[model samples]
Target: MSAVEAAPRVEGRSNRGTATWMVVPALVLLIGFFALPYLTIITMSLREASTRAVYGEGFTLAHYTTALGDFYIWGILGRTLLIGATVTVISLLLGYPVAYHLAKSRSRWTSLLYIFVLSPLLVGLVVRTFAWMIILSNNGVANQALKATGLIDFPLQLMNNSLGVTIALTHVFLPFIILPLLGNLQAISPDLAMASRSLGASRMRTFWKVTLPLSMPGIQAGTILVFVLSISAYVTPAMLGGTGGRTMSVLVVQYLVDNFRWPAGAALAIIMAAVAVIFVGLYLRLTARAMRRLP
Candidate 1:
């Protein structure tokens, strides 16, 4: 065979070897960091705590039953899900347009737009939550301006409630939604859009049919990110929500810290992890199915 023919086989073998080597490190890390910890937590969740011991060594489903049996816990879970859903919808509504704008615009403007979207991440979450607290406080700038303009008879109660948590979280995670969305949008070649337009489709129709479908991966990715973060969020909800809109994470912290109930807290943590995994798996499967249908 010619050298060129031999080169293909050699290169294929090298690539396979490289991939195999790469996977060893990944497997090691996953086993040591992710898998082992997950197993430990699951084991811990199955045990109960005793007053004399840190945890009762015996296996029992009592902790799970106790945690799941509470109506208040379910209410808190429902509220968390509501917040996550609301945040996700709002993020998509807001981020999709920004992503489309960034992806379709001239390449020169992309860096500036990315910086603008991601700048908020530079600040700490506490700082951002506190800043929102000030903005929505009864005497804060937002209320003051509204009162100044006579928009309302009284200051809007934006702080210490779900509204405050939602607003802060939306701002906090906007970049996560925007970046993935922009990536998906940018990956779609402009030729597709141009070709659709050439076929006499209106801009709106072309976007609805072409751009949006192509960008579903990003939209799904951002949605998962926003939802998971919103569900597990503690700082924003704790600072802004208080008792009125407490999340599961806040309750988990309370159980662990205030009540000194490790087993219950561990059970809650396991549930949160399971929820996150399920959400991610569903998202991946949906995205994969969409991709399979595409071409």
Candidate 2:
């Protein structure tokens, strides 16, 4: 073979080796961190707490049975889903416009916009939760402003409730939604819309037919991220939410910290992880099928 012909085979083998090397480290880390911990939790969930063994001495369906049978656990699971769904919807509504606007802007403007969008990540979650607490309290700035404006005689009930937790979570997770969406939007070529316009399609039709469909990946990614994060969140809900608004994380913390129920806490954590995995898997499958049909 000529040098050029031989080069292809050599380059292909080099690329394959490089891919193997790159993948090995990631696989190792995934097993060492995620897979190992998950297995440990599953083992704990299967075992009896008193014996601290996986089978025979400790093996029982009791932990899983208790988790499934307990009304309080089910209630908190429902609340967590509700809160996560609410926050995900709100984040999508609030973040999509910001993301779309930024994506459509010039590069300089987009860069500046990202700084503002990502600023919240710099602040501690506790601090942000407390800030919301201060603003949403009955005598806080929000209520004070409403009173000053004569919007209501009484301060609107904003703090220590589901509404407050939703708002806070939406605020906290907004940037995650925006960045993913913005990236996805940016990846789409403006030429598609311009081509549609040239073919006499209106702006709204172009958006619906071309832009929106193309942006679905970002929407899916952002929604999954926001939903998972919001559902698993601890600090925001615990701070802003009252008893009625308590989420699965709060319940897990209560079990682990207050109740010192290690096995039950592990069980709750397993359930929470399972829920997140299922939701994300469903989202990915749905989005993949949608994307396959898009063209």
Alpha-carbon local distance difference test for all models: 0.87, 0.87
User: Candidate 2, overall lDDT?
Assistant: 0.87
Residue pairs that clash (backbone atoms under 3 angstroms), model 2: none
Lowest lDDT block of 10, candidate 1: 286-295
lDDT of 2 by residue, 1-295 (tens): 8999999999999999999999998999999999999898787667666633323355676877888998988888888888898889989989989998998987766777888899889899898889998999999999999999998899888967788999898988999999999999999999999999999999999988999899998999899999999998999888888886898899889977887666777888898888888978987998899988996
Candidate 1 segments exceeding 4 Å error:
1-18, 107-110, 283-295
Query: How many clashing residue pairs are found in candidate 1?
Result: 0
lDDT of 1 by residue, 1-295 (tens): 9998999899999999999999999899999999998888788788868878878878888888887898888888888888888898898899899988888788887888888899879898889888888898899989999998989988888978788888888988888899999888889999999999999999999998888888888888898989888888899999999788888899889987888878878898887777778877887898789866864
49: Cα error in model 1, Å: 2.1
